[model samples]
Target chain A: MSAPAALQVTRADVCCVAAAEAWRGDGEIFASPMGVIPTIGARLARATFEPDLLLSDGEATFVTGTWAVGTPPVGAAEAGIAYRTVFDIAWAGKRHVMMGPVQIDRYGNANISAIGDFFRPTRQLLGVRGAPGNTVNHPTSYWLPRHTRRSFVAAVDVVCGVGYDRAAAAGPSARRFLELRRVVTNLAVLDFATPDHRMRLASVHPGVTVEEVVENTGFELVVEGEVPETPVPVEEKLRLIRVLDPHGARFREVPA
Target chain B: MQVADKRMTAEQVVAELRSGMTIGIGGWGSRRKPMALVRAILRSDLRDLTVVSYGGPDVGLLCAAGKLKRLVYGFVSLDSIPLEPHFQAARQAGTLEVSEWDEGMLQWGLYAAGLRLPFLPTRAGLGSDVMRVNPDLRTVASPYPDGEEVLAVPALHLDAALVHLNRADAAGNAQFLGPDLYFDDLYCMAAERAYVSCERIVSTEELASAGLPTQRVPRWMVHGVVKAPNGAHFTSCAPDYERDEGFQREYVAAAKDPDLWAAFVADYLGGDEEYYQKAVARRPVEVAE
Candidate 1:
């Protein structure tokens, strides 16, 4: 008989784990993920350790349970979320969001608006959805399915989400709840814990080297010591992840 | 007992639209957009329209028709499909003047207009490139000496607002059965005139029997109600029907080429609402492999 292979953990799995780690201390905060991997990560966090993580039904309700991706909400919603309630939660500084930006800079300034000059752009992206409010009101993280030099840029074309530098410029009020925490990418987990608030290499995903991350990133990342491989998802978490994303769209985003 | 007859034909609604007017089109992304009226405006040869919308294909179609002089929007997206390609081409080519706001700011602007307020104080664009890019935007100091300044999001006063809903009474009381009201009512109250196109029109008694939330635009706020079934069409009017993904895909794909786009506009938007419905009914929904 052939030996059973080790748990076939994929890059997406590591990325999800990294993303879930970003929400570790967030207590009873609204968890909003703007993309597929981030959604999986948010769902994974909710189902497992972060039981208090409030998840949206993708329709305007707060739903509990391991709801699968690519499926209409099957379970009963816990509560309704109107536009006013969303603002209430945001203004209370009780939310954490994982957003995907078209371009991100060293200081964590990201852009989801125009690509070229602000007046006349080469490409147009989804205009800033809620980046400003999310960044100014509460904690925020980033998810990058594909980590490349082009995406991790030296400077963003336009700042949609306020970064450390921009927030500081806005004065102390804008910096109150503003925390650019972790950035979970396909290759590695990054954080802005540096003194200068530059992107730092937190942990490289398994099978990826620090040099590879440096080579791919457009700007320098703070590399202090020997980087560790991001922790593999446990069997329970893996099982839950499978149940949460039955269609396997997460794998498609950050393939095995 | 006398009740107002607010019913209107799509063409009648279009007749009210003028060149250089600021209009608001309701619905989030492609959901429940008043596409029938948009088609009417497209056919009317109206130009120099400054549209305010939580945009979708309405923005794309208007841009494709060269009807838009300026766009005041949060974002123009087709949800499942990110950017509306026609809007993309127009903005990129510098053919359209755009004033983009954060989604919340756009909604706030509508709310302020609805309340008849001069401007609303918001933290939405306080410290970002939103200010740097839009130099016309100004800040308002807090009334309290201790309070910090905020961006004074101007009132989005529309000459007319077009919105679509699942159901409405003949007197113009509209109800949205969908999860989100999506600033539609605010758009209605914000405009000088409000036109609602609905999937069906029922009696006020039927509206009450349906037990829709009290969150509805009263008859006093609405000017015209048009019964344009399948009005939202490609845009999803929840509980009525899901978005026609196949048609939406085709529209998005067609927007890339001038020839294909022309053919698409001709095929679907060639005639009035009845012809468009017939075309829609005849075309089979493509089953995903």
Candidate 2:
């Protein structure tokens, strides 16, 4: 494939919100290598206004721990809690994390374990890395670099983690779960504000339309008003994702 | 009945620990955490005490001495250091009930229990047969009217969750500086009583002079506060302090070797915490080649 064009990026809140304006369902679903690597994470990070726990690490090398919200669902392996907290001490706070998954149902449920059941898992997975907590935490979200019927199936065979509805059932400590969220997809944005709490259409990506998003979705999604267009990555934001992950981990699925 | 602070001598903290009690600590790998408390816990008469953690030197040291009755963890690591033989033995023998939950579920459970909830249903168990094995976790009909099935994980409330901090005032407000926020906020809030150990007790004036007070821990939530300098030693550096790699390597080598581990433990863990300190004193300093 020919290399995509390059550009610059900055931390602008408007762009972050604009980027997620196409998000669906409480912002719990996440796709990777991100519709464009770091595009989703950076936008979400900025959208969340960089929660206290999400602050860059002390040496500015890591973030996620006592000071950071829940274990980051995104890229947190090298990340460390910037707080003066001991290992066990950090486990005691509010953490907002994001994980990339394969399937996302209307209920905001996710599947990153196996493509199918264990005996004949269509696709093997990265093991039970931490999808469980990514969903169970008070406020957890998911990302799917690809937005399609297969990726957003009616039912994920293996529910490795959670989304909006499951988090809601966890009760009181879960107050922070559903609040403050969105789901950014390659095609459009999804939300979980309705009574059923299923994935609902908010807006579509730039140059993409409602018809295109509907064609890709497997389950019936509740569509609000005439969806507006999602924000296109300003040249600069596009550049950062490309720079950090030159391979385009963000653009999960190319134009088929 | 009185909980002590990090400023309290190790002996004072040891006095509160009793046999068969469940102890919760903070840490992961051999990274950031307060090892001084672990040392104190090791010396206490606490036996068959159930332990909980995300894995690290804290769990490693406990396992090395056959002091753990049960372990609640998502994952435990002393980095290259393999887990202690006793934990492995207990796990192999089914003597120890290791309730493996997602790191988030562990936090949610603790937080749930602290809030007096019955359980926390998480997406973590969907594919895994956790519900099948741990029957306690059951699926209640999803009231969503959409017929979405879900699991109900019983709340997990520890008797106590001890944590170590970097900076704190005499009032017990603490501060953390790291990448992974292990599980301090939830655990501290959820544990019936929270114990905090800090490296320094900033003066009221110093705290008052602080710019970001939101980052500072509040005194209200803390039950007991300790001020111990270099407390993160042998565990992890508090932000600035680097990991004690040399000590970790030696411990890993020693832990995997039963004879070596036994010898080291006999001299260190086998005896009192003070004897353990003496053992520390006896170690030969590494000479640069």
Top-TM-score candidate index:
1
Pairs clashing within candidate 1: none
* TM-score for all models, in order of appearance: 0.96, 0.56
* Each candidate's DockQ: 0.68, 0.11
Flag regions of model 2 displaced more than 4 Å. A1-129, A133-256, B1-7, B79-89, B208-216, B266-289
lDDT of each: 0.87, 0.58
- Residue-pair clashes per prediction, in order, are 0, 95
Q: What would the per-residue lDDT of candidate 2 be over residues A50-130, giving only the tens digit for each residue?
A: 433333432334433221121233445343333233212223324444456788888877765446653334444432335
Q: Model 2 misses residue A203 by how many Å? A: 34
lDDT of 1 by residue, B242-289 (tens): 788889999998999889988998899899888899999999867787
For model 2, how big is the iRMS in angstroms? 8.4
